[model samples]
Target chain A: MPAASAIKVMVVDDQTSMRAMIRRALQDLGFKDIRDKPGAVEALPAVKTDRVHLIISDYNMPDMDGLQFLEAVRADPVIGKTVFIMLTGSADREVVQKAAALGVNNYVVKPFAPAALKEKIERVFGELT
Target chain B: MMRRIPIVQGEHAVVAEPGVIISTLLGSCVAVCLQDPVARVGGMNHFLLGEPTEGLGDRVGQERYGVHAMELLINRMMQQGAARNRLRAHLYGGANIIAGLGAIGSSNAAFARRFMETEGIAVGRCELGGTKARKVEFMPYEGRVRSSVVADAPPPVLNIKPLTPPDDGDVELF
Candidate 1:
């Protein structure tokens, strides 16, 4: 696992405030290379070219939703193994099952404190340090 | 005797008596409020999308689609003794929180207006657009609505919980 400062992270959501919040949380956790995208459609091209270590995405969005985006990322030869964490407002069981089946590394419910988000990331990456 | 009823995403409620308030929070989604003043009955729906597509699979879990939600609201109002011709509509929500994506809020607002116009229903008022999400309240019996722009996104807690599945038979997921 990469160190917190060395990890390259991508935050994708339809809401600007959400992206900002997540980015701030990542920064507080000592992540240096963090990129933000408004939605999945805007993130794809960059994901292919950029060496993003982890992706935090929202479930609901216009055009391409988070699940469809996850499928797309998995299908990509270069970025298929990239870690993914889904953030949602509601804990819709079916959606969670689908995401788990799609190989999501972790899940975070919205309105979560920065500490909670850091804990989930630690679970996936084996501690932030 | 004022009562507050929350309508969550993919849900609708009809109230015939006065002093009943129906409310919902929205972001990039639309809520439609319909009321019949003469009958003192009104209803509201909070929908996530404008319409369902053929490729979107079954309509079972996609109750958040605008067409189905709108139809459901209208039918329920009529069932509660509200006349269709006497119905007036108020639109709320449909905000573009994301900056670059196509204006989904605009599209949803347009869809609602078109739906009401096609059905020969009068639109009394609309509170739509802008970049902020909104909290909307509707008093069905009184045909009154109040909306305010939410400064920060509220916690994503649904006011109404999903119905618990039956203990037996094939389990269906929402």
Candidate 2:
């Protein structure tokens, strides 16, 4: 894997506080190049233009959902295969099943910690290298 | 045996030993609790909507919204002699369990955050804002809340048979 400093992470959610909380957690884990937005619609444009290495998104949002965003990322060669981890508050059996079919790098349930995210990110990066 | 207490939105209760905090259904509604450490007394309320109600229903009266529920929870603690300064809160179950807009759960959580800030109470921990239905139990003496929150799939739609059939046709009585 490349040095931790080389990774750029994008946090996507529709809630400001939730995005902030995730950002704080990413910061606590020493990821400096972190960006956040409220939903997939806002993130889609940037993911195409930016040097994003990881995409952590909330599953449900108003304009566009995380799975749709992931589909977009996969369809575009520019951002294809970027490490994607989705977070949701409820990991009911059906939702988890759908996320699995969608090819998420990691699917996390809410009330999670930095360690959980860091470990997932680390694993994603590890597999890439 | 556990007794079921149907907690309506915007209400809370303090249960004696062996009693549980029971709520029927939660869509975009949240339930929060404030527990006094030294006192070991806890209160929980389920709230609906973002603000208090100006309108009233025929039976339930009116509440602007979730704010009323938060206030009710706070008032209960105060009545129990819990110092406002020493109380800590735990939140749960603001869910977009309904379809379409994810906005409602977000609004519910935002209202809760704002209410906690204005009241000057520290929130110790919380599990809020998801697409799920939750049942929570608050152990008042120790101040522990156990939640059985089910997500994925809106609750099973019960097949309610019609009370009266259109007509009683003559069929052979078997």
Candidate 3:
């Protein structure tokens, strides 16, 4: 497992409360290098210019949605391989299939417990000690 | 002794009895409550966006959009013997909690207000455009709506100020 301290994670959500909640969850898991963006538009630029090991993004957003943003990230040469996880309120199969095809690491549905989020992250990075 | 029914995102509920309450939590999303004074019947809808076309999926998913949700609420209320002419609307929970992202809350509020106007319904109250999420409790049969800012910690403050009815000529920010 990569060290939680070394893994730079980014959380993208339009809702400030959701962002804070995710940030708190990451902090609880002992993740140190965490950054948050309000939407995929802002996140895209940051992912391009900086080094982000993992990204936790909300599926619904204005301007650019999570699927479009995931497609953009997968198309990029530098940031294409970054670990990606999607969070959404809807459990729509088509949306899940699209994210899977675009190479998302995992999916976390909304109203999820912090433990569930941690499990999805650990599934990507292995169990955190 | 009100029975509380939670209206999740993309859902709408109607109640005709006096002791039923509809509730929803909002962040950028908008909830519209409509009650017919004469019939004592009312309904509420929680919509994520202003229009159905903004969604990128099947028609079924479009139901969550404001256009469909709003129509559903109105249609359901009418089915419950609510008179369209006697319907009064209350709006809540359009907050720009995150800075830098587009003002989806503002857009949702504007869409709801315009929809009511175009439908010939009168708006009784509007609580919108702040940096905090809201927890809304609505008594549909009584036409009573209470809203509070959702806080991170304890003691959620109830916002129970006198509502100044907005002029039909202008859209006001709260």
Q: Is candidate 2 or candidate 3 better by TM-score?
A: 3
B158 in model 3: Cα distance from truth in Å?
24
Off by over 4 Å in 3: B1-174
True contacts kept of 1: 0.00
List each candidate's DockQ score: 0.01, 0.01, 0.01
List fnat per candidate, in order: 0.00, 0.00, 0.00
DockQ comparison, 1 vs 2, better candidate: 1
Q: Which stretches of candidate 1 lie over 4 Å from their true place?
A: B1-174
Clashing pairs in 3: none
Off by over 4 Å in 2: A127-129, B1-174
The Cα local distance difference test for each model comes to: 0.75, 0.65, 0.75
Which is the leading candidate under lDDT? 1
* Residue-by-residue lDDT tens digits, candidate 3, B75-133: 56867888767889999877877676568778777777877776678998899777688
Q: After superposition, how far is residue A53 of candidate 3 from its true place, in Å?
A: 0.4
**Per-residue accuracy of model 2 over A1-129 as CA lDDT, tens digit each:** 666556799999765556666777776666778898877999999888885988999776655778888888888877888888887543234655666666777766553545556666776676222
Q: Model 2, range B1-174, lDDT digits (tens) per residue?
A: 655565656456754344554444455677787788776667777766543232223111112235434544554565566656787888777777777765778777777877677567798777777777766766655676677766675544333121111121121111
